[model samples]
Structure formats: C-alpha cells, structure tokens
Target: MLNSNMLRKLDMQDLMVFVAVYEQSSVTEVSEALCVSQSTVSYCLKKLRTSFENELFVNTRSGMLPTSKATAMYPHILSILKIINTCHSGIPAFDPTQKEITFNVCAPEYFELLILPKLVKRFIGSRFPVIINITKFHRDIPADELMEGRFDLVICFGPNFHRGVKGLRSQVLLEDELVCVVDKNFTLAEEAFSLETFVACQHVFPTPWTSDTNMIDGWLARQGYNRQIVARANSYVAALNMIAGTDFILTLPRRIQALTCDENTFSHRRPPAGLPNFTLDMMWSEKPSQDSANSWFREQIIKVCAEDGLL
Candidate 1:
C-alpha cells in the first residue's frame, strides 16, 4: 500500500526530524536539538509516519523505541541526508574564519594525548569557530566510513593500516619510536639498557584498541623474545597509573612519554635497539578532494603538526 499523497507532502525537514527523533529517542529532546518547537517536531513525525504508512516509533516505558520499519529506514535516510549535505557544501571556496563548522574525527588515544591539545590551540589562535568531535578508532576501513559520512578525518598509527582500502588520501603526520617508561627509582642490573633486562622486568602493556597483539609483541616474536607482561591496561594513562610506584615497566611511543610523563615521578629509557619506528597518518576519502572546507581542515592539521615539530 502506497500513500502517494502523503509522500508528496514530505520534505527534507521531515527527514531531519525523523533522524533527530530516532537518535534522541525523545520528542522534546529532538525539538531542543533541532531548534524547533515541540508541536513542529510532532507534526513532522506525524507526517513521516503517514508518508511511510508505518508506525515508525512506538512509545515505551524506557523511551520512544523505533519500529522495525524505522530501524530498516534509518541508515538509508542518514545516507540520503549526508548526500544532500555534500551537494550543498560544493562551494567554490571555504573560509574557516567566517563560517561555523564541525569536523568529526576518529583517532586512537595516542592522538588524544599527544596532538589534540596543540591542535585545539592552533584553532583558537587562528580564531576559527570550529567544533571538533573525537571518536575512538576501531581498526575499521577509513574509506568506507568516510564515504558514509561517518567521520571527516581519521588519524591512525601507520599508513599500512589502510593499505587495501581504496579511494583514500593520506598523509604522514609524524613519526615516533617506542620507549620504556618506568618509575624513576627503577634500575637495571647493568648500566646499559639491554633486551635481557627488558624481558625480565614485569611489564604493563597499554591496549588502546581491541587487538590482543601489537607491534611491540610482534617485534619481540620475530626476535624470539617475549616480555613478561603482567598487566594489560585499556589506556596509556591507566598503564602509567598501574606502574606509578611499582616495578612494572611500560613500553609506549616516545612522544607519549615526553608529553605525559613527569620527570620526577617517571623516567624514560630507550627500548632495545632496532625497535621499529611508527608514523601517524591522517586519512580522508578521495571523493571529497574538491571540498574546500575539508581541504582547508586538512591543511590546518598538517600545519599544526609541523609547527609542533612533529611533522
């Protein structure tokens, strides 16, 4: 059963309302988020339900839960809105100083700890009214998510992470090597930092992502050596806390140690020779290459990294 008349009455505002309501799960919240009155949101929802001839949402004790039809339609509607927004953004030029813009970025905790502060400072100094939303990187394909408008940019450890993903433009932002962080009082049997001492020490590993194995473990495996990792932490901060007054050593990026560690509380030692260096990369979908706003944003990131001597 099709309702051509009702469908013809639907508009982009109605679609926006549907998405807002679905995400917020409250009509009042949707109204506040969309800067519309409650009556307007209700009218839009009513129109959408009529157009689709479905009870898209049902009132529940918990909240306004989406019906099966709404669940199925959510992604499609979101994609449509993204496409429309892209079309509308195809301007000749972008001026960050004059426009209010929001950039959604996906990155690991490393970026948050080392780069985000300086990046925000750059924006503030330049007087750009920009909003940044950061999300955790889950080792997903940046190209697919960027194409779907999930994120405007992605910051990852190495360029190889996106090797097989097509239509992605990436740039190396910075390079860092592994370093061992331990309590200042920690000492080695010998003066020189040796692999034997490193492996002998009880280590605290930082697991920022879901992967059980990391570059450190892989490198150790290749050399037929494994460290005695006694604890696994979800973040570098947590790992640092775990090794604060203990004998546990944490092996992490050198920049992280430089930025986060206190000279009095913790000291950094060079990891065993030949540990591989890693590069941080910024990636975005190639489809938006012509988007001046995105282009400008990328330039800003690179500029900030360079100014900080990280590029």
Candidate 2:
C-alpha cells in the first residue's frame, strides 16, 4: 500500500516519459515524440528512479528497457487511468435486446427438460439479441474456475461455496423428492415400495462424485435398508436407458419421474413414504448486472414449473 500524500505528490510526467522511452526503446525517439530535448528525458528518468526506490529502466545498446518493477507497474497504471476516464462517464450501457453478446451457461443436463425452455422464452420476450451457449456441468469443475470468470454462471445443488464469492444469491429453484422408477411393461406396483422391496431390487444410480456412493448408502442405513447400486452413471439418460424394461429401479429426482410419465406403464414409489426432499439451485457470480436478471430468470423458472404444479 502507498500513502495518499506520496501518491498525490509523485511526478506523473516521469512515468509518462519512462513509459514512452521504454516502449519506443529510444530516448531520442521519445524526445522527438514529446517535442522535448533528450536531456530532459534523462532527467525525468533519474527522478523516476528515486521515487520508485529502484532503477526504473536499464540502458541497452538498442535503447532503454524497463526493470521488473516498472514492468509490473505498467498494467496497473494503465488500468487506473482508463478507469478514471470511465468513472467520469459511468458504466458502458448494455441493452440485451439488441446487443450482440455470448452468454455461457453451465448446468446439469437434467435441467434441459424443465428450466431451459422457459429460459429461452424469457430471452425471446426480452428480445435479447444474443446466442446462449450451454455447456455440460460436472462436479469436478473447480469453484475457482467459475469465480475467476471462466463461466458466467453455474447451476448446481448448493450451500457449498468458496471465500470472496458470496456476491450472487441462491434460491431453492425446484424441490424434487427422490422416487424409484422402473421399466414399463413391468409388474412392480407403486404401492409395493416397502423397505423389503426397495432392498430387493437391483438399482441404477446417477452420481458424479465417488464420495456420493456413501451418502445414499448412509441415507438407506437410516431406514434400516441396504440396496445395491449395480450400475452407476453420470447422466440420467444413461441410467434411464439401463433401467428400461428391467427389474432394476432408479432413485432419482421426481422431475425425471415426469420425463417418463408418457410411458404410463412405469410406476414410482416414494422412499420410506417420508424421506426429505432434494432441492436443486441456480448459482451465479455476484455482479451489478446480475441483480435484475437473477430475479427475472428465477421468477420465470418458478412460473413455468408452477403451471405444472411441479415447483
């Protein structure tokens, strides 16, 4: 940190001269560009060295070159000067409806069936003139990648976070009770999801984390049940395909249960008849522009899901 007085009293001309000479690599060139004598450029470099407490530049056969300290200061000085200019004017205006923008949204594929359609409609109604590119989400992506701006937003099951990243808010976007789904043309009844039947059937699980193998097992232990996860996959589609036309049952979000509702032949059973529900959430990095967008998007999501009484 630097003192306010030191900052106020420092010679701005010296930095300008140093930057010009360093960039041009010729004091003669700098002097000519600034319409000053070469001696004046040398004098300013000397004064800059004293203020910086280090040699700000070193002379080479070609011309002058920046020391490490000066090199480090270059970017910060440029950013500060630009920010000063921008502050005087205010933030650049952005109108989503007409601006050409690329938005990167990351989320589980399960979200495709429920929230994604409304998100598209909201964009259409807003007349947002931008393409939305959605990419895959995995548990393995580090939170730092999202925080450091690689992603505009990441939607996941939340309550876990890293420091310096509490800017965006979180809401229970959807509540899904885990239910058991089986292949159509099967005889298993929804009412038969007793503890014994649950433990007896082969199961397919969708889990991204190896650590999660223990979480569901632990939950089963609470109900005095033990089930086998004969197959595990990272996707619901894969799990659905594997469990099709088989005795295998899948414990998954109820929205998934609705996906196969057209196959009315399939049946579902609630775990223990009273297990707590699971909630999925949308998480975004906090930003000034996100305030209104977040509220609007969340409302649209709730509205669509509520229309189906699924929220």
Worst 10 residues of 1 by lDDT: 187-196
RMSD of each: 17.7, 12.3
User: Measured by TM-score, how close is model 1 to the native structure?
Assistant: 0.67
Model 1 local distance difference test score: 0.85
Task: Note the Cα lDDT for every prediction shown.
Answer: 0.85, 0.67
Native-to-model Cα distance after best TM-score fit, residue 24 in candidate 1, in Å: 64
lDDT of 2 at 282: 66
Clashes of each: 0, 0
Candidate 2 structure quality by residue, lDDT tens digits, 1-311: 77444344456566678668768989889999988898999888777777677887888897688889989988876666667667678554455655566666676666765677766786788787656677776644335655665666666653342222455545667767677777776676665477777788789987633334333576678877788879988777778788877888887777777774446556666765555566666666655234444444446567766776766
TM-score, prediction 2: 0.58
lDDT of 1 by residue, 177-229 (tens): 88888888885543335887778889999887656567888888999999888
Best by TM-score: 1
- What 10-residue stretch in candidate 2 is worst by lDDT? 157-166
